[model samples]
Target: MKRHPRRSVPATLTALVLLAACALVAVVTIQMLLGETPWIRYDTVAAALHGTRWTDTVTAIVGAAAVLLGLILVLAAIIPGKPVVLPLRGDLDSGASRRSYRSTLRVAASAVDGVSDARVKLKPRTIAATVTTGRTTIDGLADAVRRSVEERLDQIDPAVRPTVRVKIRAVRKAS
Candidate 1:
C-alpha cells in the first residue's frame, strides 16, 4: 500500500482541543456526582445562553470564520498530494527519492574527466545539470555531461525518461 503524507498540524490541534473539552466535561460530571461545587456553574451557562444577545459584527465574524475553516478542510481533502520520490523499476518494494536521483546524477556527471563539480536538478520531466570545469576548456563537455546523466537515468528506469539539459562553466581562479 502506498503511504500518503499526513497534514499533522491541523489534525493534532483538533485532537488536543477535543481532548481538553472531554476532560472538562469529565471533571464537571465528577464534581456533580461527588456533590461538590462545579468548575463551570450550570446556572451561569443557562443564563448566558438564554439572555446573551450577539452583536451583528460578532455574528458576521463567527460565520466568516466557520465558512473559511470549512472551505480549507474541503480543499485539503480534495487536492491530491505529490510524492517526494519517483518510483524506479528495480525498486518496486522501495522507491528512490528525487534527492537520491539528484545526487546520483551529480556523481555521474562529476565522474567525467575535466568536470570539477556538478550540480543536478531532477524535475518531473527534466534533468538539469550544471558542471564546473577547471582552467582547461573541454570541448563537448556539456554534451558529455548530458550523455552521462542520461545513461545514469536509464539505469534507474524512471516512470518517464526526462530530457537531460547540461550547462558547463569554467571555474574562476582566485586573484
Candidate 2:
C-alpha cells in the first residue's frame, strides 16, 4: 500500500516517546507498589519484591500491560494524525466561532448598496469589519457597515461593540 512519506518521522518519534514513557511508568508503579515514596524510592522495594513471588509476578504483569497500552496509543496516533491534531478553528476562544458567521458577515456587508467587497473578523470581545465600498470617501459606507453589523450583533448580543473600517479599494458605476 502507498504510504504517506511525511508520517514516518513523527510516527517513529511517537513510538520512542511511548516506549520511554512506559518504562518510566513501570518504574514508578513498581516503586509505589512496594511502598516506596512516589518520587524517591526506598531500599525496601527490592527486598520486598525479591521475597514475595506474588508481588514480583504482579509487577511483571502490570509492566507488560502498561507497555502494551502505551504501544497501542502510539500506533493510534501514528496511523491517523487527524484525530491527534485539532482543526485550527477548533482552538478558537470566541463567540462567533463558526466559519459561516464570518462568511455571512462578509456577504451581508457586500450586499449593501455601496459595498464592493468586505471581510469580517470576529474575536471574543470585538468584531472588526473591513469593507471596500465603491466611493471616493468610505465614511458613509463604513457607517452603513457598522449599522448593519451592530443590528445583527444586537440580535445576538446587544452589548458587543464592533469596529467597522471601510476602505474604498475601487469605485465603479452601477450597471
Candidate 3:
C-alpha cells in the first residue's frame, strides 16, 4: 500500500509563475502588433545585456538567482511528499490510511468509561491520545485509554507499532 501527499501547493506555485511569464509575453507581442510603444524597451534591454560582463556583480547576481529558482523548482517536482497512509504488517497489502487507523484508535479511546471525547495523534514511534471527560477526577482514565488503544493496535497490527500515551482532561458542562 503506497500513498503520497497532494502536490497542490507546488503545482499551484509553478502555474502562477508560468502564467505571469506568459501574460507578459502576450502583452508585449500584442502591443508590438498594434505598433504601440511597449512597456519593455527591448532594444535598450538587449544592449544592456550585451554590454554586461559575466563577472559583473549585476549579471552574477541575476544568474545566481535564476539558478537558485530553477533548482528549487526541480527539487519540488522530484521530491516525494509524506505518505497519507501508514503501512501495516499483515498480508493483503491493502492500503490502510492513517486517517482510518487514527479513527479506529479514537473509537477505542472513546469507548473507555468517562471519556467524553478523544483526540489521537499517531506517529511511527508514539500514539498520543487526549481524552476529555466530565468526571472531575481523572484517576485511571489514562490507563484505561492506553489499554483500549493498545487493544486496538493489537487488532490492527501495523508494521510500525507505536507506544500508546494517554492524557486525560476534565470539563464541566455549562448550562
Model 3 misplaced regions, further than 4 Å:
26-39, 47-80, 171-175
- Model 2 off-target regions past 4 Å? 1-96, 158-175
Candidate 1 residue lDDT tens string, 1-175: 2234576766777789889999999999999999999999889889866764566676678889989987887777666565566766653565677668789889999999889899988665888888999856567888888888888888878766789988878876545
Per-residue lDDT over 1-175 for candidate 3, one digit per residue giving the tens place of the 0 to 100 score: 6577877887898899999999998998899889999878789889988999988999889999999988987888788766698778877786578789889999999999999999999765898999999987777889989999999888888887788888878896445
TM-score to true structure, per model: 0.71, 0.40, 0.74
Q: What is the lDDT of candidate 3?
A: 0.86
Error of 3 at 104 (Å): 2.2
| TM value for model 2 | 0.40
Write the residue-wise lDDT of candidate 2 on 1-175 in tens digits: 1122356665687779989988887888887998876653546667866776654777789889989977886776566432221123223433443465567667767777878778887654556777775575555776777777766655544234555544445565455
Q: Candidate 3 at residue 7, lDDT?
A: 75
Give each prediction's root-mean-square deviation over alpha carbons: 3.7, 15.8, 4.1
Local distance difference test, each candidate: 0.79, 0.62, 0.86
User: Which of candidates 2 and 3 reaches a greater TM-score?
Assistant: 3
Which of 2 and 3 is the better model by lDDT?
Answer: 3
